[model samples]
Target: MHSLINRIMPSASGAHLFAVVALAGLFIWFGLMNLAGLTEATVERWLQPHPLAYLVTPYKTWLPYALGAIQLFAGVMIAIYAVPQRWKRVSYGLIGAISIASLSLMFTNPVWIESLGGFPAIGSGQGLIKYVAILGVALWFLGTKGANEIMLIGLILVLGWIGAMKFTGPEAEGVWPLLTGSPVFNWWLTDFGKQMASNIIGVVELITVILLTGHWWNRKAYEVGLLISAATFVVTLSFLLTFPQSWSGGFPNLSGTGHFLLKDAVLLAATFILYRD
Candidate 1:
């Protein structure tokens, strides 16, 4: 196991490079999804209920496209900046754009309180709030050296906590449809039954958490954890394709589940960053 970790762990510079590329990939994919009109309804749903709705209503039709373009441009810039001799001006641009975009969600998304849970309670927002980690990662790539470690710890917390929740009744029920729709996961239902299947998944997630957080103690475990985490995201992301009902009101309009699943993109990126070594 130690030898395997040594083989897989990247050089410090390589890790940073991987983190940048991972983030760029996320931005590009999300941008394309928006430009393709696939996330329009989801955007609208979040925007329409906000206090600034009227201010944004007139531009609603084109806003998503514009944002998509910006994300695409930022992604391209990040990719370009990854080159050794590249000018870092683009990194600055990305920092500004991503910071504004991510921070703006606090006001634009109405479900923040309910999803994130208020104060003492852990709510669905636990997933959404992790965007701050992405923001930190972007900043780290741009210039903040310490941000990488901070973001990694943040990822451990969020993934660990959420993974732990999978053992609880509501979360288990909530994820059932996703599990059932997934070919990779569906067989668990027949073989282990719902409760056992869910517990199995929960165990997988907790193991991932332990491995990720325990990297300092055992790099081998961390590398293995990263593999499991990546695999987990891959399975969850597959839900978007396997379940047509992910989108409602026809192709573009996302149901609650669709919105919930879409956030996996960012989490996927974080996993790469964490495992980049």
Candidate 2:
């Protein structure tokens, strides 16, 4: 057992391989569970409390399958290929397709936003993030070995979008009641801590992106890129867990579609770590 444990322990690349496997498993498991006819009540009781699950009703039926397939492919590539040079381009293409389609789906469907409340700018900004991210993915696909800089640019654009969306517009029309604390844990929009946390994270991410981009030509570029990717993975996972697990299923749960959106982020992170090594 000791020897086996040592064997499985990660190398610089292995760390990323393990993460890819875990991520793939989560996608397959959650996706399969939802596709199966498991009772929502039972699943909820077993999983613990989360934001409403019924909200993601529209996208869940298809999105999970897509995600599961991607995760599975990613895990397999990492495991089978010691060096990702050949597979890297394929992975980027898959991720790019997923990102572009997911963004289109999100913007093309207004029912979800309307079901809650529609802010024009928020919708527009989300579209922009996906657009820029697609460009970032394209850069990687073009065999730019140091594609981290492009990714950093994407992150900065996304962070700006996030901050602008959260801190301004209809949501920010009024000065907050100081008494209402930050909405850190609450899944709903009303929570002050949650909004503040989102904005702060966005700002920090913007700085990180800028630094990572500036360091692209530096000798330590790969190292810096890996750090940025790790930070993003943490944030994406945190966002996933912070919201209700069912949120991915439909309406009240933005987490479902949101998870698909993060798919590229994960792929990008993995790609960078691999490229750096």
Candidate 3:
């Protein structure tokens, strides 16, 4: 099995090394930031519009610290080439767990959906559909190489749901006009652009999810999947920066865009380590 893996696993390139190191550094930073309680200040500022702000507020207290620690651990393990070898199943299992929690939060939290709103009323339905979809996706990750597949399926579902909601829902309708009509040229339309960009990203995410999930059976495909995942992280960072309002907070506290972008940057860096030998 060791010989088979060596023959199958491609040699690590400069790009792979850079990505792995970056991932480790980011996760280490993330974990440290959480331990320092920086996440609380960040989350408190960004969640102004959330209905269950009070209910989820506890996250500010511990989640950042916890996830940051996880990031650091995952990063170190991957950087050392220990995860996909000695801890492959455990590593994937953790990914699956995180994905499930993320999906659950999406359904339960209006703020999350609101962050990605395309039109105005598209964010309706009281968050039930999102929960069901997230749960379904998370369930797909229980088997071997299931995390990638579940992610891909979730992205497809998110795209479809958002697209359909934008067309038929009221909130989405409000946001869509800014994208299509005359006001699109205005600076204020930046919010609309951000949401649209997120939707477009959803398309790419769907593709990546499918490619990564299915790549286990084909080594070449697996390599491509890693590249796609890295690219998605870059795209998300660009998208968030481009639309300041999408972040929804003041400066210094690292609310709104600051918080999210930082988190994602960290996530990207950590995940990239998985590609290295």
Candidate order by decreasing lDDT = 1, 3, 2
lDDT of 1 by residue, 240-270 (tens): 8888878876555555566556656555665
Each candidate's TM vs. the true structure? 0.70, 0.48, 0.44
Kindly indicate the candidate among 1 and 2 with the higher TM-score: 1
In model 1, the runs with Cα more than 4 Å from the true position are 6-21, 36-40, 48-58, 80-127, 215-224, 245-269
Q: Tens digit of lDDT per residue, candidate 2, span 1-277?
A: 3343334334656645554554444334434544443334433432232233355445554544555566456435544557465685565565556555545544434413342266444543353354454445444445666554555555555544454554543334321221133243334434545456456545655555555554446534534544555555555555444434426465333443353344444445443444443
State candidate 1's TM-score.
0.70
Error of 1 at 267 (Å): 3.9
- lDDT against the true structure, per candidate, is 0.66, 0.46, 0.47
State the RMSD for candidate 1: 4.6
Error of 1 at 15 (Å): 5.7
Question: In candidate 1, which residue pairs get closer than 3 Å at backbone N, Cα or C atoms, i.e. clash?
Answer: 115-125, 116-125
Q: How accurate is candidate 3 locally (lDDT)?
A: 0.47
Cα-lDDT of candidate 1 = 0.66
Residue 257 of candidate 3: its Cα lDDT?
Answer: 38
